[model samples]
Target: MRWLFPALALMVSTAAFAGADTLFVGGFQNAALARGGSNFLWYRVDRVPPDAADPVQSCIDARDPYGILANYHRAGVRNTVRTQLRAMRDAGQQRIATGIVHLRAPAGQSVDGRYGGTLIDSTGGTLHPRIRDNLVAFLRDVYRAGFSELLFRYFPQGDNTPVWWTTFDESLFQENWQLIRSIEPILQASGLSYRTDLGVEGMPRAWFVEALGQYYIDDNRPDNPAWSEYARRIWRNYVAEFDYRRSVGFSFVSDSDPVRTRARVRHLRYIYMLADGSVRYPPLFAIDIYGGGTTDERTIFERHHHAMADLGRNEPWIVAESYFNDAVAAAGLSSAMATTGRQVRYFLQWPLDRGIDDCGVNVAPPNAYEAWLRRGF
Candidate 1:
């Protein structure tokens, strides 16, 4: 009974029922606030060292001594996170969602492998013990921070080297599932509701079917032999596993490449409908509109929003990530917090006008903490 309603379901219901509501948005920084002209913020807890003549020393210096001490010493990072959560609560926001990357590196690790335990090892691999005790410590900190909702990024394909989709293997999938199970107790204890990002590439049918017992198919790829079988199994599994009243959903990533984008969109729509001809999942689609440095700002927003509206007619949609340097560079677009703010505002307003609800902002580092607070306010 306690697991009856996932946090995201509650959010969707609230948004759908509420009319003329202002979406409190936050992202990597004030961009969310600026673009949407809404009050919201998302904080980033991870530390990246500043640049210096000696990159290693600079990286070491960049580590937040207060954050580290707060985690390693004192009540630990969780306590420090609580302090930040309190700040947001004091600002009068009833709901707060925290974002944390589950990462691992040996003690005293630096970038460039000059020092051991860098983000990626010599073999161009992410740190092992990917989900470690420190992550538990961080989650405890998140709970202490007074957050009841969280957006967990299992593997951020964009920032991580080689990308998750490119290197995804059976071992990685198993590791991720193990981590999820291990943290379930903590999540339940903290009363935290979570949403995870499935990378844009969309997972293989076998991986999802084997891991979660359900696989999301890209509507764009309807003809793929794998999708038909996957769809069949999903229907059978859904009836056996989930309560119909509870909302089930998945995310989709749009690529800049026309061919890839079409394929993704087609596959996503196909999966949106179930064998019974009912909308099996909430239409909470996500697109990577960051442009990767090549898309025009207006064009990127317009195309992605229009695409989502076309596919997500009766359901809500969210941007999994936004305004990354690579996206901008790939699209040949130039944007700042102002541009980001405007786009978010447009997205929020569009849905409200159409009588639909629910949207989310992705928050990352540097000014993430500040952005988190701003959104709540």
Candidate 2:
């Protein structure tokens, strides 16, 4: 039985993970690199575009012939997304949509019209009529924006199209499961769309279970409970979201970590494998590893690479974000390339569009960090 585990794991991985590398520079900081035949570019919709034009249009203008991954923070009520999609279609740019959407249940008002009642009531439910209406309006907005095509960017069946869309950015579980539970049925009834990543926290003891497991639930979960209750909360919070999303339409919902330790990565893969006994959920993962020459930074990269390889020869994952010293940008690139799988499904470095300087990497060009990336490509 012990030996059979390896064979079964190999079979699962071989069937689950397969695709060419898809690297993305965090933003348009090195737009020229994207233009000069390097990796694809990523950007947030609210951020100003390189040409100071529309965000979607500026990305298309890069002439990458591939596409850009976009983050949307607005409430899906955009008046101009239709025009933007037209421009994108004309250029044949395949845009992948991500980013957060804050859909809270409508607050109840007092008779005096001053304050409110409990947002989530005693029922442990959130799908009020108003909440349902809000979801409907949002879906209608999405339909008008032509975002259904954008959100459904990946092929539902296989790993050949490993593009990711972490739907709620880093705020997925933060909004309470009751809210998400309400949203899911609306998503189903509205027939808005399907297939997205759940943007969950990576650092949790639920990922690990030696012969004896440790207890570390996120702040969103109950603090201390009996072992059975602890297990139930973990299943509800971490494990059940995948099945719920899959039930609606999501094919490969991903879990991302900061990539600080190999254990986190290994355990996440373990959780994905064990929970997904049927292999319905591909072992999709994401990591964040800032690169540099320092021992701490280099160790971060090394440990992540080792952990990423635990599953199979070519497990597709994303280098979601990073920061690197210009002096050792090549070393950083090399560190990013240190994983068992030669392919990088997606690579989006940090602060690609922000004006502020992040560890010397900024929006302005002619910076050492941008130069370093160009040299590597």
Tell me the lDDT of model 1 at 145.
52
| Each candidate: RMSD | 12.8, 14.5
- Give the per-residue lDDT digits (tens) of candidate 2, residues 1-377: 00101111222101111122122446422211111111112221233345554533333233211112111223442334334434433332222232222222224531111111111121232444443453365445545544222122111111111112112222222333444455555555545444333332322222322344543423223222222132233334534564433321221122233332433443342233333353333333444444433343345555555655654424444444444223343354454454332444433343332222221122211122343344332
Score every model by TM-score. Answer: 0.48, 0.43
Best by TM-score: 1
Any runs in candidate 2 off by more than 4 Å, and if so which?
A: 1-77, 81-95, 99-175, 185-194, 205-259, 269-282, 289-302, 311-314, 322-335, 338-340, 347-377
Candidate 1 C-alpha error for residue 291, in Å? 5.3
**Candidate 2 residue-wise lDDT at 296:** 39
| Candidate 1 per-residue lDDT over residues 1-377, each given as its tens digit | 00111221222211231223334444433232112111112222233334346543333333323222113223443444556556644543333322222222234564332222212221233223432344455556655655433444333222221122333343334433344344434444544544433222232222111236544434544444443334334333434443322222333443554444444444544554565766455424434343333644346555544544565443433444333112222222223323433233111111011111111222222222222233321
lDDT of each: 0.34, 0.32
